[model samples]
Target chain A: MGTQLDPEYVRTLRSDFAVAHKLLSDRCLYESAKWSAEALNGLPEDEVDDPEILIPDELKQLDQMSSSERRQYMLAKACFDCREYDRAARILEHCTSSKCCFLKWYARYISGEKKREEDSEVILGPLDGDATINKQVILIIDEIEEHFRTVAAAVYDPFLLYLYGVALIKHKCDKLAFEPLTRAVNIYPFNWAAWQELGRCVQNVDQLPFVLSQIPPTHVMSKMFEVSTSQELFQSTESVFATLAQLENIFPSFLYLKIQRAMLCYHALEYDDSAKLFDHVVREDPHRLDDMDMYSNVLYVTE
Target chain B: MGTQLDPEYVRTLRSDFAVAHKLLSDRCLYESAKWSAEALNGLPEDEVDDPEILIPDELKQLDQMSSSERRQYMLAKACFDCREYDRAARILEHCTSSKCCFLKWYARYISGEKKREEDSEVILGPLDGDATINKQVILIIDEIEEHFRTVAAAVYDPFLLYLYGVALIKHKCDKLAFEPLTRAVNIYPFNWAAWQELGRCVQNVDQLPFVLSQIPPTHVMSKMFEVSTSQELFQSTESVFATLAQLENIFPSFLYLKIQRAMLCYHALEYDDSAKLFDHVVREDPHRLDDMDMYSNVLYVTE
Candidate 1:
């Protein structure tokens, strides 16, 4: 009998078992979907006809426990799937065992959900399964604080730190965003997205010199100043001239910068300087003539 | 006379100039295409009967100038458009700054068709045209060098480097392909294509430890190996094992890895080890009992 139960017996049993598993799985899936739909529609739990369909007996057994216990079970599944472990942990408030507590914490840690106490043991533990979920949650929280903090704080996870810096800049937390963003960009030099976003972040500041100094001269002269004047009116006519002088030093042969400077001069009614810069740029890079013509139209209107 | 040359005169001149330029440009473009097609097809240049459709007279005239003068002119145009400069420079071989000298050097540089130089400035010149041609040429040259160079060399241009590295790996130049591919990965980490290629490059080496070491431990033990290995016998036994190890790591609790590994082990005739790994993986991840049954059949065959 132990000699593999005979081929025919095994085959029949296998087929029967597969059929049962499939039926159970299909039923479970259908019920899960129904429950999800009812929940999404905000129907009362009692109103759920065959709510049992949504929570299979196996899963419902966990739900029969306290909310915290149900959350613990859900958290384990969530961690397995690498889904919303932080939200699951937040719902699982009463987990007390060190392993369960750390599991909840590490889920937050790895997802960049939040920063907790920097205990070395907790940080270095096997960041797999529920532990990874806690880690992700902690990372997410760290990102939130790093981005929203009035002063920049160092982040342990470089990826999360990079994201945090970008979020800060996006939310107009300029002063808070600068240092971490700068560090992130410096750390990951080949990260083009970080460089582009950091350029945008710094460009938010009023002073042109600070922006010019930070970015590559080519990118600075081409991209930053195109939108800079439009976004920020020069504090004075001389402020515009000073910015132009700094730009000219940075990009000596950049025709577009010269044209932009010329436009600024023309806007200030400094026609001679405007005409000279425009003519010089047209001679050097004749492509600038199209831009110069457009600027001239704007000049005519402004006048 | 100055007053007579007013808006009407200027407009008329502009119209006449535009027409002439368009006609000339169209003619030039057609001739260029014809020449390019001939070159690509390996047709003898002397056999072409159409004299009018040969190189443009203006370009030919520029080619007749002194070498220094031609070089200066070519450099100016190269700064604007590298493809134009390459074509123009190719025709100016008779000049002191011979077309042969510049074309050979520029082609090598643009294609990363030579060994890497330490000076970033020397390597970082105008390669901003026809990236596909550049990649193809670099890949071909890289193959030729694979026979000669005992050590792998760094490929400078990121895109061409990646293509060259991928080709090197395809030809079984694992050691030669490693550096450029690793560099490409470092440059573009999120580039899934590069990552996949890098994985392939490492896998080409027969030793499991070497191959596994190149990838992240989690990846080596997880998903990459499972997805990459085929059921075909053409795939080396070592690769199958590496893939199994990676799958086992990725889905430690999934029975699929165990089944696949068992199949591989049976094929490799390492029946016992395969059975053990498969049994352990399946037992831990009981959700895959169906797969475990299939795996047991393979084990029965091996036994």
Candidate 2:
């Protein structure tokens, strides 16, 4: 264990796992999150049994394609998967399938973001740090919003609605993002990414109930969103704790759930209890360096 | 993208994903690592098609159990999954199956680590910092070493050998760890965790060739290990870079692979090439904050 955890490489790995875990949790890929947590503790990767993803019928209709078209589609997909976004967009320029359209526009959006990361020369206002994106990125967002808006108007695909919603959110049109995101969750509530986007559009705690009414309130995903949003806004800790406890039962030893509970305890001014919970977390996952900044505060207060 | 990436919550998330990425890379779960990279870039979760894990026959014999025994086994499993390690260990005290024995001992070992994390009063040597573990943990290592030494002599389970090797390593018995870890990689070469432990036992570049000879020469895992260990010792970078480039072709846009190449370029004093690669990685994964310390160093030198 000393050989495992005391090394400089392990320290670097601990920090990296922290970031990955947060992303996995945000995506509501909790099973993957569990794998990360185990990995953080120097536990070996247990071969997991993930449910198979059914390929959409449209995607499965490759047999109907001309060989050249099939080759183009396959090549585009390969390019897209490798993050060669521009090449993927170029190859799919004339493909008329819904998947192709989504892919092309999505690639364009990502390509634009990549450009933004490279565009460090953009002058920032005195107050702005890395948050001020380049005009090129803004142009791409506008293009994404325009394309997704048109595509979503014609089709009821949940993913299309989600992209439309995300584009709107990116363009800083949260009011416009609202309906598409709601439609997205209504169509496919299990996609936590859509729910998270919807959660972002929500302005305040008072607006949450109305937003909650618009989607499937009984869904565990909605409950998760509610808990997340409420925690973000620092409201209704008691109910959030209860809901999280329920989620804990569902996702046993979920690191994110435990961290949230620990945060909730801190928020409630249960300093000793929060400290203990944080201690428990540290004990189980000693290498987890993220989220424990709050634990540090808890320790400070208790000490 | 601004709304997604600019918020304080998102800043926290970026740092978190950094840690999680490192852990996932260390575990060699690159498919899940890809998911994390996407998540960091604010990409929606794409439904993945993960291959199913085959259940070993020993674990599949649950149907042959008496109803009461089955109930007991499931209860213990539930307790174990929730991280009630002590409860799980107690529940499996009388169980005799190989799986049960592994679980029982593994739970006990984890429980010991947890206790050590909570043991805050242990005096550290002047040179020791957070690396100084409590006596309780050391005691558990001693117990684990003794248990595994006896158990491994009678069984050829790769996982058992892994645990035994880990115990010996913890007990400052790397000589003992070497054979078990070698046996582990020989028996189950795909387990990156065992390979990592084996890698730790290697003292210098001179020892690497002999170690490499013990494992499957043509296996991709072995190749990955060779690249990893070579990079760690900072020897044979030209060959290591070639291996990593081959791996990059195999796993397109693998962040860790890209980062490794960047580091290798930096090591070779190819600052311009390394800077360009780092810039590309940053653009593709704008939210990745870990491994960019080297990027910062590159920038400092270039400036």
Candidate 3:
């Protein structure tokens, strides 16, 4: 049987649980928060009796606080972190609006959450009121554009256009998303993520090369291969294998490159090279055990 | 009339021409090399007489050599660089096949170049009718594989297999191209190039993802908007504008992205944003004057 737990060790464990409880409660991870609180409440007072098993300084700090007070503090912090401004505002209602609720609410609004009437005016009031919110959004986006007008510009601030564009895209306000993303790409020709998202945006429209050419040469090649390899283009195993081989050089480090190559080799009856590359990858990475098994099955049937 | 060229200036230009000549000659960029050589020959003989010209020492040394000898030397270097081994071998026939030539020939052969019968292999010996040469080539390839394996064990080298696979595919060796590209992707999950090529390879032989996924998610949304805007997917002007607006954020600074967006916006009758982006790009980069003219035509029609 396992040795009996030390009274001091049990006390230490209970205190550590209290910190996690406070953190989770603040974040509104309610279930985890409640469970942590309960666990702390259930700690036996007898464990505190043994001097050798005394609670550590860290846990003792929480000893003075009531469970309800700790829960409220943790819950407020969590809501703020998760950008649940309304919930956070309710918890921190006694605090100044501008200091606490206002910033969080603005961040949420910018992240695409619909704003309350009070929050809406507070956030949108800074912009020219004569212009519609959509137009105001456009102006803000334009400001970002002016900042990144050169190739050397630090245009990849995730807070600026990237988040704004993502919000606009998700909202189906594509008209709004266009300028900011284009400005971002123009400022940094090497931003592949922007180029890819752009390709996805204009794929249905005529004249794809215009969008494609804007992407870096390497990214364009990769996107081309991605579109080509997907089942959207072809259905046959033979054609799939053939296409994969053509793109091998562009993505040499990819495991799929070798597996597809091995598959094609098996089909071609070039067993030697196929076996060698396959075995090499499997041996190097145990994570590919499943792939090796599947490959072996194919080889068995083909042979 | 302009003052006579400075002697020092003439010498400097001549030296610049000589360096250019050497680089071009080394690369077998024959036409450029000849131009530089001719420019050196054309330098004025008397430096003091041409005050505007400044001939450098390097150009003076080159100019002292007989034109015939220069031509011979340039031709030999060009032949060597171009891997016209027999031509190089003939020129250096009196000299035993140098170590450099042998190594060069061996490297070329391993890179898949066929060996010429007449060329002497002093260091590695004739590759033809020699099992040892084939074995050595394989060993070298294995060594390269081992080095890559040690450095980037997680990533496979798709280039070699890809090259062979592409050759096989081009030769209707579909079975061959399949495995290498598959292997390429397996090694690198984010290899978009592999994915696109794989799609193309299977397009002819299999049921494409187009049939399976049934209109990509983006296109489905586009079609919905197209219907709402009373436009066909590719036919209606509104559809074009909608598509461009959508793509703006996705491919922000891409010149082609802007052009396509502008084109689509013109079709959709959203002339303002279309013209603005177009005008901005053209105004920012006058080198795209031709594109501006095309955009202007679109604007005229849309307006």
DockQ of each: 0.01, 0.03, 0.01
Interface RMSD of each: 33.6, 13.3, 39.2
**Candidate 2, superposed: residue stretches over 4 Å from native:** A1-172, A196-213, A217-303, B1-125, B128-171, B204-213, B217-303
Across B124-209, the per-residue lDDT of candidate 2 in tens digits comes to 74434346443434554565555556654545556557767776776678988899899877765645667778989999999999
Better of 2 and 3 by lDDT: 2
Per-model TM values vs. the true structure:
0.27, 0.45, 0.21
Task: Name the best candidate (by TM-score).
Answer: 2
Off by over 4 Å in 1: A1-141, A144-165, A171-238, A253-303, B1-303
Ten contiguous residues minimizing lDDT sum, candidate 1 chain A:
A43-52
Tens digit of per-residue lDDT, candidate 3, span B1-303: 223555675556445545555433333333334334433434455423212223345333323333223223333333443344444434322321222222223333333334333343545654433322222334434443444455444434443333334444434556555666566544422222333344445533133333223322443223322222222122445445555445343323335445655655555677787789788777643333324665867677657
Report how far residue B293 has shifted in candidate 3, in Å: 66
Candidate 3 residue lDDT tens string, A1-303: 223546665556444544544333323333334334333433444413322224345323322333223223333333343344444444434432212322222234433333323234544465333222332244434433544453234424322454356446654667667665665455433233443444445534243445545544554234433433332222225546555644443333445456656655665667776787787667643333324664775556546
Scored against the true structure, residue A119 in model 3 reaches a CA lDDT of: 37
lDDT tens readout by residue for model 1, B1-303: 112223443333223222322222222222222212211112111222221123334333323444234323333322313233333333332334322333433343443432222222343355322222233344454543442264334323333445556556645676787776666545433223454566565443354355445544443222344334343233436656665554443234334445566666666667787778777765553332334554666577657
